[model samples]
Target chain A: MTDTQNSRDAVVIERTFDAPVVLIWRMWTEPEFLKEWYGPDGASIPIANMDVRVGGIRRVCMEMPSPNGPMQMWFTGEYREVVEHQRLVYTESVSAESGPVLSPTSPGTAGGHPMMTEVRVELEAVGNRTKMVMTHAGVPSDSPGAAGWAMALDKLAANIATNRGR
Target chain B: MTTAIDEDRLTETFAALANSTRRAILARLAEGGATVNELAEPFTLTLPAISKHIKVLERAGLVVRGQRAQYRPCVLDATPLEAVSTWADRYRPVWEARFDRMDDYLRQLRRQEGASEADD
Candidate 1:
């Protein structure tokens, strides 16, 4: 029995990079650069395809090495708003299609259980540094995929700021 | 064991830490392990009440309990707490971006007002 209903949970990640606001925004929109730094340490992005336009769907899958075995997660989202180099908003769902399904509580729990998520990415300039904030709202409190997504984002930011510390 | 540390686990952990009393209990455990009596000594509630709070903490993996004779000792588990720090550190840029956006909006308003003043 599914005890979880849809709930809104917000996570704000603010990082100041030595690069300009535009450069930082590029790292997010460009599929090639994003492929270099999107998932966790061991997770790799074999599929980084994006339409980069409004109402366009971007589907990316991550290959994660698990102790039990190797696993793959399909992160499919639609680009709701794509403002030049300032702000980007997208709604991400676990299913391969456009509708909802059973929510996956964790990373490996996706096939039978699926959860929907929405992420907003904003970029602004702070003095010589650029600050980017991505807020993820409407994640199930009991879903495992939510936690995996948080980790993946953290690793992604670190990979971007590996050299330039601000 | 829900060994998988994911968003759901984090929410449950944070919700458990949302309580001030439970946070204090964690602070106490950090110093060293303690039993129900020792854990409840600093609290205003009874031992049974503290036990309930400890149970919540244990479920979140913030604290671990061991059976020793008649007393169950609680140990501080810092692994799950690090998850919050790791996740928050990712968005240091996002906050700066928001602040800059606000600053630009204010600056533009000032510039527009000055232009009107010059026209007058």
Candidate 2:
């Protein structure tokens, strides 16, 4: 689907920071700085390996507390494009510690993999401040993968409505 | 940790949701529980086909079929869908925190730069 159509599925976040583009870029590309703020609340990043060149590999691990105790989620990706202080594009996938885990049905492919997505980050310098627009694509929208979810949610609303006698 | 198992279930849930007809059946169930015949009313598919769709939803833990007398009503179980929604939203807070930290780090760096410039 086109980006416009896929917008419904994608998560687009735009923020302006009172920092130069160079500094903002470092926060994203430098592992030490990235680890400080790259995870959800209550999660920590113990390992972040980032190779800022094109075709370089990036591996990050985010550990969070689960009901069963601590759990680590590994994400591995490759840098498809890296423009200094301006833009970065990567294809990321959830994986095990060893490496990318092949799906049982598709031995060599990660397509249709729910945990896989493409991230595009664009940084623009506005005077000394920086404006960043991050688009997380590959979130299945009305496609077969997510078609049921949209409809199921609608049905759920309907069920709730009927039960409330409204 | 059962993380692998949870991931597998998430995959199954996505796969089960990948069909329009199955989604329609689920929408029907959301109105209330219904037998195979009642669920299949909106679709042109056969009873067996509807049953098959219900089975997929059941396997994904999105639906539960009640065993009542002659009517086996399929009820919508939104727990799994809620999980899916939560997963989708997992990154928002992550990036927000990262940006906040970046702001602090940048302010510190600028202050150091100013101090060194004055010393020079």
Off by over 4 Å in 1: A1-60, A63-71, A76-85, A89-120, A124-166, B1-12, B44-46, B82-120
Q: Pick the candidate with the highest TM-score.
A: 2
Q: Write the per-residue lDDT of candidate 1 for residues A1-166, one digit (tens) a residue.
A: 0111111135555656666677667667777656556665577778876778888777777677879676666667677799977888876544322223323223223443333456788788887567777676544334434443433433433433442253
Tell me the tens digit of each residue's lDDT in model 2 across A1-166.
Answer: 2342233235577889888888788888998888766776788899898988888878789888879787787777778799999999876667544445544333215543435556888999999999998876543322525433444554555565576584
lDDT of 1 by residue, B24-76 (tens): 78767766789989989987898789999999999889889997787879987
* TM-score for each predicted model, relative to the true structure: 0.43, 0.71
Angstrom error of the Cα, residue A158, model 1: value is: 22
- Poorest 10 consecutive residues of model 1 chain A by lDDT? A1-10
Each model's interface RMSD (Å)? 13.0, 4.3
* Per-model C-alpha RMSD: 14.1, 5.2
Task: Note the DockQ of each predicted structure.
Answer: 0.06, 0.37
Candidate 2 lands at a TM-score of: 0.71
The best candidate by DockQ is 2
What is the total number of backbone clashes in candidate 2?
1
Candidate 1 chain B least-lDDT 10 residues: B1-10
